[model samples]
Target: MKIAKLAFGLICLAILASNVVTMSRWSEARGVYDDICYLRQAHLFQRLGLGGLNTNAALDYDGYFEGKMKQIAFAEWQDPIRWPCHNPMPSGKDVMQYPPGTGFLLALFPEGHQVAPLYIAASLIVCGLALSGIAMARTLPSLVGAGLFGALAVYLMINPAKASYSVAPTMAVCAVAGFLTALWLTREKRSVLLIALIGLLLGASVNFRLPNALLAAGYAIYLAVAFLRMRTLSAFAQGLGFAAAVLVGMAPTLLAQAVNAGSPLATTYGSADVVAPAFDLAVLGQYVRDMQFVLIVLAIGSTAWLLRVGQGSVRQVALVVAGNLVVNLGFFLSHPIFTPYYIVPIAMLSLWSTSFARLMQPEQVRQAASLGREPTSLGVPSR
Candidate 1:
């Protein structure tokens, strides 16, 4: 078993090294409109600090946005109103439509050399998580499963993730959140603090991609159901704590919306993105032929497998994952648009949570079953 584990660990390391090399060769000016917009946001933060949240086109006095647009041969490069991702507001201000998180991450590196380092760093963190998952496996089959999944997760950093700058950091968050979800669900005693931390992580994800807010659907549904059934002050408090933490985590995006859109509840996105939800066969067809469908199938199969064989907290974790998959998939499938990376976050989160739950089952089965039971206080299992 040790020998197999060693071999898999080395394979993961090799994959990580290859990912680093690939990332290093990436060019920041890839002629993508989104990349230029994200870099402009980073330039704003670097220049204006917190004041960068107000992403008005007037801030581009130094011609940073113009330079990027011209590099792509944009016909209207001289006009801010003609920018690809910037939305014109009723306030007569054209603002970048993306959330501030990815730009903030890019700003951490020096100008003109940000994309490579950001992706390389994200790949390293994901590789580390994969290795840790491998280490936690107690049996041969589990070890191999973790090793394979980890390798694939690391390799994906360059494909669909590279298609959008926001996806890089979002992938890292999903990896960490999946592990934490398993840990919180399988513990003998429920911890409010743990759930709050998970909420904060999901909330922070919104800063990267606005749609990531849907990632909390499963957690919210599970907690709400738990509280309603138990009807205890502790259960209520637990749910409340988680909700508050999410709001706190989303503070930056909210502030940006308020500053740019005239209200926090309002969106800075253009009309095309604000349309009503309706099932589109073309969009559905795109997912059916894409890699995301394969992942969704895997997530469903894994959740069903866990429910069939798992006991106590393991079953609870499976239920949460199942609900999350249903909600997120429903939204993306019905929407009028389709993207390669649109469903990746939910798929990865469900996969990671289930993978970790399987690895921890031996210990989790020994713990007392507390989920859906009456708690003593603060939602902690009564000893």
Candidate 2:
């Protein structure tokens, strides 16, 4: 087992090194409208600090936005009204349509050299988590599974993740959240701190991509059902704490919305994004034909396997993952747009949670038995 673990760890490290090389060669000016808008948000933070949250077009006095547009030969580069991702607000202010978190992350690095470092840092974090997962595996099969999944997860940082600037950070969040989900659900004693941290991560993810808000659907449903079933103050408190933490985590986005859109609840997105959800067969077919479909199937299969063979906390984690997959898939499948990275977040989250749940199952079962509460196949106490 030790040798096998070491082998997998080395494999994961090799993948990380390759990812770093690929990311280092990336250029921020890819002629993508979204890329410029995201970088503009970063430029705002670098120039104005917290004041950057107000992304009014008038603040582009330095012509950074114009310069980026011109680099791509955009015809209306000088007209803020004609900007690609900026939306016109009712208050007559034009604001970048994206949430501020990605920009905030980019601002951590120096300007003109941001995208490569951002991706590298994110990939490193993912590689670290992959190594941790491998270390936690006790058996050969678990060790192999962790290593393979970890390698795949790290490799994805460059493929679909490279598809969007928002995706890199979002993937890191999902990986962390997945590990936390396993830890929180499997423990014999519940930890409010763990739950809150998970909520905060999920909430922060929304700042990277709006659709990431749907990532919390499974947790919400699970907590609600648990509280309803127990009718206990502890359960209710858990739910309340999670929701509050999520709000706290997403506070920056709310503040950005308030500053740009005149109301915290108002969105800065254009009409195309704010449309009602409708199932388009074409969109569904696109997903079915994409690599993301493979991930979705894997997540579903893992969830079912865990539910079938797992007991105690493992089963609970499976239930949450199952609920999450359903909600996230439902939303993405119905939406009119299809992006390569759209469904990747939820799939990765489910896989990470399921993987950890399996790796930790033996320890959890032993702990439950020691507490005189042997878990039945249905995940309830045998007594």
Candidate 3:
């Protein structure tokens, strides 16, 4: 068992490094290409002084995205070419249509990296890798659970994408961060402060991609169930704090989307581009196939856990899994644009299962430890 654990861990490490190196090697001449479009969307915020996109800039596409080295990482909206809107756009609506999260990230890119998202994308992926690593190390058991969990996390985090700019890296970061947040927030001595902080983190993630609203829904359910179980007014106050922090994090994009997109929820790409009206049974199968091992393990584990036995944070893990899966499944069922990247939250939450499961006994253990009365007769030291 020890040998197998060592071998498994080493393999996971190699896979992790290989994926990281590949991502590190991307450059402008190679990968950035159109990915920087999000960055330019962010730049519009800076150039136009926090107002909506310039109408003429988007409609008049003359020399807007041009330069030597072809370093034009920008877009002047001609028209938002999404479902329900077919005419050539006469306004700048499309330019500022996307959520400001990715754009805000791009705005932080160095002058050189902006035209190419390679470095930025790689950095975000690395951040995700680091967080997932910490999550597994802190939560999972021994060389097997932790090793397999880390391997699964890296595999999900490193999948190829159309651009690391919007879909890939942003979602990956949010998932990794969200998973870690859940682990911390669900600790035995959970507090209103902790709940608010969790709310703040998950709420902010929603503005990154509108579909992340699904994640928000799941989190809201978890919080609701948790507080309801406690049945206290302070628990409700925690909810308010979470709401305030979310508004703080999303102030820029939320306002911009409302004013520029005409519909606060409408993105630059528009709703039609985000979701397909053609709902089919096959899309569900595609999600299953795309998520691969992660979803399979989750499905199997969930059936057993839900039907047979589980409680405490174990049940919380189930909630996270069910919440993310149910919401995303409904969204992706008809979302023609749904890609593997869209499943980051699902994969991430799935990988986090062990961590949450580890929290099975909270209050009694915490109280015992705090009073310096830990049981040592069995010597089965708890992690």
Candidate 2 deviant stretches above 4 angstroms: 362-383
Q: Write candidate 3's Cα lDDT for 1-383 as tens digits.
A: 45565566566667767765765565544424344445455555556545523322343233333331144332522223421222223353334335666656556666445533533353456444434444434332433555565565555445544334555544454545445544544465445665566556555666567666565566666567757876767666766666676666566666665565555554545444655457765765676677544554664465355323433444455565567667765665666654556666554554454343443335554355446555333222232
Rank by TM-score, highest first.
2, 1, 3
Clash count, candidate 1: 0
Local distance difference test, each candidate: 0.88, 0.89, 0.51
Model 1 per-residue lDDT at 242: 90
Better of 1 and 3 by TM-score: 1
- lDDT (Cα, 0-100) at 375 in candidate 1: 31
Estimated TM-score for each candidate? 0.95, 0.95, 0.71
CA displacement after TM-score superposition, residue 355 of candidate 3 (Å): 3.4
Model 1, span 334-380: residue lDDT tens = 88898999999999999999998877753435332224332332323
Candidate 1 deviant stretches above 4 angstroms: 362-383
TM-score of 1: 0.95
Which tens-of-lDDT digit does each residue in 1-383 have in candidate 2? 88888898999999999888888888888898888899999999999999999999999999999999899999998788999999899999999999999999999999999999999888988998999999998777778889999999999999999888999999999999999999888776768889999999999999999889999999999999999888988788889989998998899999999999998899999887887789999999999999899999989999998886666788889999999999999888888898999999999999999998887675657455447565554334221
lDDT accuracy of residue 251 in candidate 2: 91
Clashes found in each candidate (C-alpha, N, C closer than 3 A): 0, 0, 6
1 versus 3: better lDDT goes to: 1
